[model samples]
Target: MAFLEFTRLDERSVIEYVKSVAALSSILKLDDEGDAAEKLTVKEIGDGNLNFVFLVTNSVHSVIMKQSLPYIRCIGESWPLTKDRAYFEAMALEEQGRIAPHHVPQVYHFDPTMSLIAMRYLPPPHIILRKALIAGIQYPLLARHIAHFMANTLFFTSLLFHSTLDHKRQVAKFCGNAALCRHTEQVVFSDPYQISQYNHWTSPYLDPDAEALRHDNLLKLEIAILKSKFSEQAQALIHGDLHTSSVMVTPESTQVIDPEFAFYGPMGYDIGAFLGNLMLAFFAQDGLVDQPDHRKAYKEWILETIEDTWNLFYKNFVALWDEHRNGAGEAYLPAVYNNPEVQLLAQKRYMAELFHDSLGFGAAKMIRRIVGVAHVEDFESITDAAKRASCERKALNLAKMLLKDRAKFEGIAQIVSAIRQF
Candidate 1:
């Protein structure tokens, strides 16, 4: 359990491992000579696909310990992955924490050899944002908080704040996390469109829809551009899997977790992943109830969240760019962008492109969740197959339209209106 090398840790063994590490044992007050170890409890959590997460707690303080399995946990050893994702997760936590510590968990310890990391525990009442969405819980401040997070994290890491030398060095380092990036390319960008064995849907209900996607030449072309952008763009450090489940939240707190897929990629990938999942939650509301408005007004709230998230993100992101204009960022220089009018136009053009990119990426994310290997529980928990399929089809159709015509969408309000049409 307390081995010096990597071993698959379980409840009993994890306790021994924790007690062996002072930083962890200190939290539980575990003294080798005392009964403190016995008082500590270890509860395994997370339904995630890649890691083993456990909550090790004493009578008072608690800490979360996570270890990466060398394979996908949900798919098992058939799909082997690198244990080194723990290293990237640690790196991302450190960097993102530096930029937005309030939104990210603190890393107390990282053991590269063991592929393990221990960090601040987000206790009860702090639920996974996806689960909370399905449960119809609302975080009134979620939009503002997420805006601050994306704006600062993306802006601070990009050329606007970093010199080319520093940015490229960081990018080169993250290139080591190629395994996860390749996996994303497959699942998110590739598998869903082709006849991949891993792809599945509501089966007979979505069989036609899936077939339609497979044969849609224009849609395939659209996705191809996005996949290439994902492969080539190094706009900023993005939380590659910024879907709803990667977030933990309460009424007053919103914590972003799982940057295991973090990389230097298109900033809109993160923005789109978030907004796409929120859209999924919105569509799932339709099939989620036997009676209309069973959770009355929840859909409207979801719509507001989607709209608010984009709008606030736009505002905050631009604010940061303006504040740091005279700073060290290389993308836009005070000399070249010398005038007030030129700067205004540059910012407008940038935000407009980002807005469309977010829509396109968000739509792509929605497609994958429904028809790819991993499905969101929002639709899964709908119980009745027909109802769930009904929900999924609407989301699927909307996603297809967005992917093809994301450029046509002028604003978040228009996207919200389109969501209602389905």
Candidate 2:
């Protein structure tokens, strides 16, 4: 009944693991009674410089079995990764599910000892949102759903959910992943901008101007503004990485997965990551538009959604805060909610920094996929070189400018204005 041993797993071993997971599900009565179980087929379906993913499917049932290796398997043994990431991811999923059940996938089983996890398979039901965007189809309701998702999950899971002391305890526990945090911190805040040997964009498809833009001191200063707000905004147990790829969507459904990078980070980190990818998609539209009119139309919708999403988020967030905190006896109640001026200022400041961080991290995410090692399906799907480079450059420029002028950009209006000017 034991699954594949982590210490001795290869690609074929993945098949054995799938069989075991399927068997375990059967024992738990997950499927129909006494039906002959179908042999599980495992296929690789992940996009990143790290980790291996196996989608285990049989005739009547399907599940995902993800295993963490000691190093990047695709890159050989040169790049190291801690298998313990599975443990962190599983734990994050457990907590997030409590606050936002529909937003994340359900985890049926997990083994910390093996650094592996099995969960409900969301098959043809959902496609990665990143892929959907590259095809130029817009999810008119996505901005509202995601904004509400973030507002509810983030507000309730933070100090706002529990008392200050309880929230602090939760934060301290996740902080054990100092190594993971360091990786994100360096990737988002440090390395990409510097001329490190590790930094390089994919050839021919990279914009020389975009590459040089990362080195601008103004952009670095903008990132600093975001880094500064990290503490104040650390009021929640965030998904830590809520980008487009992390979100699964169809025309009528949206479900987010991969809280493996989840942690007690700033609420804005979640917001920024989600919105940042939209900005990435927005700028990449030009490359998708083959025609000027098409580009203008698509770009307008993207920009307008950005504005609407923020408004929806704030309107939803304030209502949640008021609903939960109004008359609730807590030491920090009046101070946190009563002062509109201060709250508005804090929110304004936070939004500005969120814009900057979104840009910086979006740039890092885009660049890393193209150059460093990991690449995204959105850009990779573009078969034409000129088209791909055009999309990447547009994204990279916005990223650089947002990071450079983060402090000066007050709200969505200014940010949108600046983006249009570019």
Candidate 3:
């Protein structure tokens, strides 16, 4: 087979492309010496707004093949996006996999020209976390596993682990991902606050609320600050889209996928995205209720999960800081922060800021899902408009409060209490 030029792949073309690539064929044991190619099955499974994902499998082995199209999948060719996002996704996977191997999938091969990546396939019993949350299914290790993943990946990639020279090198490398970053800035921060064609809601029910959001001066001011930090703070190499849908989980195994928006940004941005989406799921539970009790216990569980995720992430992140305080980390020098009093003060101040950032960013994510272009299934899957709007309004109100007064929060417990009160 000869090397083919860049072209959008379909079900038929994927098979030929796979067979032509020795690395992919070898994964399925489908080389000239093997017969798997004759019996191979390929299924297109991408349901995202950005890429084409295929499940390629044979009788004995399987791998996931993801190819980036030159445009946004949901809006069609009218919105031209770079297929080069695949390259960034592959790079992030390799780097994040190195830092948190237990939670990241392994990459087998990458083709820059084709904008494709062949990687490990997470088989059955593994499903998107958002789907599991909607079904009210519980994963025992989800909180612990995700906490560890965030801590390791963020800590190791930040100035706390890397010297200034190394950190700058990485920051420069990811700057090319500005396009995706711009998209996030628009949808997550800018679009919701203005009258844009992409902005939407549950219609008449949320019309007034959406309008108020556009005119709220305090909310706009707060969001502008967050936007500035998001663009200026290169604190770590973050999974820029760490929502529930980006996570794949079973009772024991957790894997993160689709890091096409990976970039050097505030670590709290990543933490906030996950926590915010979980909150969306929590509020949407009202619409999913079938009994009079209205899933009270499940709601409590969701709140607890939110509290646990943040508390665990803080504990683990602080532990990493402690363990590496005397190492080559350039953020806080041992000579300057050597005393116990100073270390305690520094850690306390650092944690306080992070907590606020997480709350603010989380609130932004919640607001975006309700009024921004891309809505979450947690709210969208509900069949009843009135019920969905009610749940979304509660979420939207809570998010507004959090975004404006996040600095008042001292701990995750306080945030959880606020959610309950709302």
Q: Per-model C-alpha lDDT, please?
A: 0.91, 0.68, 0.92
* Candidate 1 positional error at 142, Å: 0.8
Report the C-alpha lDDT of model 3 over 1-422, residue by residue, as the tens digit: 35456777777788888888888877788865657888888899998778899998888698898999889998889888889999999999999999999999999999998899999999989999999999988887999999999999999999999999999999998999999999999999899999998888999999999999988999999999999999999999999999999999999999999999999999999999999999999899888876627678888888888999999999999999999998878989988887999999999998899889988999999999999999999999998899899999999999999999999888899888989886
Q: Model 2 off-target regions past 4 Å? A: 1-5, 8-15, 18-23, 27-35, 202-215, 225-233, 292-296, 326-331, 335-373, 383-387
* Residue 39, model 3: Cα distance from true site in angstroms: 0.5
Report residue 213 deviation for candidate 2 (angstroms): 4.1
lDDT, candidate 3, at 256: 95
List residue ranges in candidate 1 displaced over 4 A: 32-34
Q: Residues 1-422, candidate 2, lDDT per residue (tens digit)?
A: 36535653555666555456655557333356553344545687766455667776666667777778877666768767677888888888787777778777788888777888777777775888887877776778878878778887777766655777777788887777666766666666666666655655546557465366466676667666655555344567777767788888876777878876777777767776776677777766766656757867667877887887777887887677667665432424666657878656655565565555555555445444444444566666666777777776766766666555555655677777877766
> Local error of candidate 2 at 199, Å?
2.0
Instruction: List the lowest-lDDT window of 10 residues for candidate 3.
Output: 1-10
For model 2, name the residue pairs that clash: 218-404, 219-404, 369-374
lDDT of 1 by residue, 296-332 (tens): 5998998999999999999988989889999988898
Comparing 2 and 3 by lDDT, which wins?
3
- Residue 383 lDDT (model 1): 92
